[model samples]
Target: MTIAGSDSGGGAGIQADLRTFAFHCVHGASVLTCITAQNTQGVTRVDAMSPEAVTAQFEAVMIDMRVGAIKTGMLLNQEIIKTVAKKLVAFGCGNVVVDPVMVSRAGAQLLDDDAVKTIREQLIPLAAITTPNRYEAQILADMEIHTLEDMQTAAQKIYKLGARSVLVKGGGFTNELKGIDVWFDGDRLEVLQTEVIDTPHTHGTGCTLSAAIAANLALGKPHFQAVQDAKNYVTEALKYSLAIGQGQGPVGHFYPLLNRG
Candidate 1:
């Protein structure tokens, strides 16, 4: 299941997550925490759900369905983040994947300082794996990432924050380091790479990657292998990126289906 905000443009958040899940032949469920009026250009308006509404949606899903894995995205505020962390503990939910949506690739701050603290203290410790982009990793790890070694160090530091594993994505890197990612479990530290697809239509890449990881976990892939497979999946999806909007577009979630036709 994906707990995230809604993107009316259908490029990221709940829309991209569900598409990625279905691409893996997994049933997708959702609990929306907010709604955003956004397109490739950018977000114009955001309306967050109350904590009570989020809780109601969470309980309704957890009570009846047998969820295999859970992926969280765009948790709007501190109250909602707290509510989600508490409920996940209450229900003993495992295989949780947390995509820390605190910073954008362009260095924009998405979440406030207090909400970031709540995620660091509460949500991350519960994550089976936490995926943070370069800027987000810097915030969580409290260091700048310039080289691959820096990414490794950031991953190790973030691993200490209680996630079973940390993946520091290097999508913001230029030249040879582009598409490289550093993975650090408590024991192993490794770099993951794929051939960079040169395109401006790379919206939703982070959300798609993390959701693919959760879907693979639901399919019983081991943790390290899951990240490897997801990296490969996103690489291919980027090859078919959509050039729909005036600005950045999205990766093709249904590339296989598109290829079939």
Candidate 2:
């Protein structure tokens, strides 16, 4: 299940998660935390839901559906973050993937200081895997990341925060580490990278990656394998990304079906 915001463009947040789950042949469920008035250009407005509303959605899914895994994205505030964390533990949802949605790839700030702190203290500890981009990693690790070593250090630091594993995404990095991701499970560290697909239709790459990982986990793949599969899926999506809107289009989640021109 994807516990995230709703993207009106239908290319990210709950939309991306559900499509990703469909690609992996897993049934997707969603709990919308906020509604984003956005498209390829940028987000113009955001309307966050009440904590009680989020709770109702969580309980509705947890009680009725036998969800296999969960992925969280775009939780707009501390209340939503803390409440989601509580529900995960109470519902015994073991496989949790936390996509700390603090900022956009375009370097836009989407989360505030208090929200980040709450996620680090509450939500992250409950995650089986946490996916944070370079910027998000820098915030969580309290350091700048310009190299692979820095990625490793950040992963270790985040792991210390109580997550079983952390994948410090290098997609935001420049130089050699671009499109490379560092995964550390408190035991072994693995670097996953794919050939670069030159495209600006990467609006929801992070969300898609984390959702794919959750989908793979739901299909019973191990953590490392799930990440690997997700990387490949995102790469393929990028290769065939749609040039839908004016500014930056979203990755083609249904790329498997469309013939790229």
If scored against the real structure, what TM-score would every candidate get?
A: 0.98, 0.97
lDDT of 1: 0.94
lDDT of 1 by residue, 80-139 (tens): 999999999999989999999999888899999999999999999999999999999998
Q: Write the per-residue lDDT of candidate 2 for residues 32-141, one digit (tens) a residue.
A: 99999999887899999999999999999889989999999999998999889989989988999999999776567778899999998999999999999998998889
Per-model RMSD to reference:
0.9, 1.5
Off by over 4 Å in 2: 259-261
**TM-score for candidate 1, residues paired by index:** 0.98
Candidates' lDDT values, in order?
0.94, 0.91
